[model samples]
Target: MNESTRQSSEPETKRQGLSGNALGAIFMLLSGLGFTVYIVLSKTLTEDVHPVFLAFWRSFIACLISVPVIMRAGIGKLKTRHPGLLLLRSLFGTLGFTLAIVAISADFDLTFSQFNAISFSRSLFVTVLAAIVLRETVGIHRWGAVGVGFLGVLIMVVPGVFIFWAASGGDGFSLDLGTMTAIASAFFLAFAIVLVKSLSAELSAVALLTYANVLSSVLLLPFAIYYWSTPDLETWGWIIVMAGVGFVAQYCYISAVSVGDASFISPLDYLRLPMATVADLIIVGMLPGMNVWIGAAIIIVSAAYITFRDRNKKAQKVKVLTDR
Candidate 1:
């Protein structure tokens, strides 16, 4: 508590914080890469299996994978007395995955620029939802960043509709409903993330994942039943790959945030944009041009700005309450 002791501890604390951040960043980076690969592989398999069916089965497999682990940890320990909130979180999580992956598989060949542009909208959605649903406050500065981000979206989108590809068709394959669904996936995922954060103080990350995946799989079963298609050997191979790798990526990501500050860790999620872009360029020969980067840059900047402001506001509130 003395000056000399506190001064000596400052450097040590800072170093440890930085080290933790670095480790968390590496896990996030790898998790992002795994998810990027999942998207690519999902695209590769869309020729055979519907994305809805694919998402459902993969989630089912993930549930199976996580069960033994959850049981080993003691399922009784995982169960919170609060069941309703857990159900809502799982429902949102399920909708997010089912809609997003299905949309991606259906429209993997859409303009990457527009695709990425729509992806950016999720940050804005999350910010707005945080205010409305979580009762979080937002000030003018963060709102300004949201506006600038949307302006960048217009820049990327306007040209695609009127440019070279316009001659091929109206909107040049822009305005696809699947693209919008993917964007909705981002919104739902963000909201689900916020819920997960709220629950983190009460539940272990593994427990939350176990509940979410299993419940989501159950919710999607009706859809899967309606669209049932027997998986051939080729389809089975991709589903297994998607299930295994996607589970790894998803678990790593959830664990990353569980062990670190969300404000510090969430920004690393943006790394997926570049990873997917590069993978598409290398594997599928889709070189996303300036528009993708420009729009994505704007979105990433805006999302980071929003998170930073929120964290500061939250810390200020804590300080105020503690002062009283």
Candidate 2:
């Protein structure tokens, strides 16, 4: 290729790259909106159906949706060298899904915004788990971010604990089941992520997703059957919509990451916090307390910093390898 032609092609390539990133940003925003809708629907339907049952249906629907993808990718692609780890990952993921639903349900006192805000702690958990489990070097910078993130979590939860204590005339301090479950869900989700990181070396993304959804459906089946209550037609309609929206959200997130750097798109996910807060006010007629706003801001900034730091580390590693 001639120099003038190469220069012209370089400009076109840059334009195409920018367009892809723009599209990725749009997809990330849509994914956030879709997940917010799914969460709001879950909160609404949990009034009439058990959370375990809802989780099973969601997983089963996702599995059904994966059938086409698996068929196209070839069933052999679903095979993995490490079945035990995959199963464990699915179990943690299912637990996370069920607990998250319970946390946001009417049975729990937590508002949608609080649930969303607390969920951001998953990144903090991931950093800690990566250091301990994966033995990845976590610098003091990330450790400090993790600390700040936990402080944010405490900021959000302690206010409610004190409120409960005051209501009890200072007899005791307690965290509500909803808050506890939300935090637990984040830990389990982060564990699942760590497991996925281990498994990704041997399994394709399609296989990983398929295994998780199919295994989650199987794992939750008995519990779902035990807790099942027949939903009215309207409730069933919403359930179906929720599953479809959740699947689309997952697709949008994958699409965003495929087209752009994950670190660039990840912070857009925090959009769900405000989206959920608005959704709660409009749908559930509730607003997040001031603590939620302040705490969520802190957690998001910390998590974003951690994400970028990880990205930079990976880039440096790649650069070093290329320079070699």
Candidate 3:
């Protein structure tokens, strides 16, 4: 192309990139709002419904929701060469989903902000798992960020546990089930993410999501039945709404990643912490402790730095290859 033509096209290309990034940011914000709604609804319903049962219905509904996509894509499109790996991925995902629900259930007594803050640790867990399982190289910078991230988690969790111990007159020390389950959920979710990264080369997104939801339904069916309590009509309405909102949120997240630079879009996801905090204050009339706010800020900074570093490394590698 001639100099004038290329110069004109450069401006247009920059504009388009900015536009796509703006759209992705909007989608990320909407996703954060949708998830906040879903979590609030789950907390409300868990007043009467069992979390296990709620989890089963969520998976079942999500599976049903995927029907139209599958039909449009053709059944053969769902076939995978790595069924065993897919199953393992689904198992970890199901465990993560169920435990997350349980962590926020009424019986668990965890505030929404606390749950959201802890959930951010999934990225840290992913870094660790990638190093160990994927044998990915971990530079000192990323390792330091991970260390800071765990320190943030400790800041959020340890203080509360100590206060509770003091309240109990220091008779015995025990961590709350809610905190344990929240951490477990993040770990399992990270493992599932690592597996998905491995499988993405061989499977389409539709296949991965469809298989995960379907298998989650199957795996949780027996437990759901054993713990089942029939929901009233009102509860049923909320359950359906929760499923729909969750699906849309998941779609928005996927879209955001696909359409724009992931590093640019990812920090927007931290909006969920504030979104949840506001929703909790308005709906449940509760605020997370000061530690939650402080710790979550630290975790967000750490995670964003990790993402920035990873993006820079990838860009450098691409530049090296192109130079060669």
Predicted structure with the largest TM-score when compared to the true one: 3
Model 1 per-residue lDDT tens digits across residues 109-210: 554334545666777877777778888777899889889877766555445622454354324435457666777787887788778767888888788888
C-alpha lDDT of residue 135 in model 1:
85
Measured over all alpha carbons after superposition, the RMSD of each candidate to the real structure, in angstroms, is: 3.7, 3.1, 3.1
Cα lDDT tens digits, model 3, 93-179, are 999989999999999778899899999999999999999999999999999999999988887877553235345432322358899
Candidate 3 overall lDDT versus native: 0.89
Q: Which model is ahead, 1 or 3, in terms of lDDT? A: 3
Q: For candidate 1, what is the lDDT?
A: 0.76
Order of quality (TM-score): 3, 2, 1
**All candidates' lDDT scores?**
0.76, 0.87, 0.89
* Model 3: pairs clashing at backbone N, Cα or C within 3 Å: none
* Residue pairs with backbone overlap in model 2: none
Regions of candidate 3 where Cα sits further than 4 Å from its true position: 1-18, 160-174
Off by over 4 Å in 1: 1-18, 106-108, 111-117, 157-173, 318-324
TM-score of 3: 0.92
Cα lDDT tens digits, model 2, 156-211, are 88745323434543232236899999999999999999998999888877788788
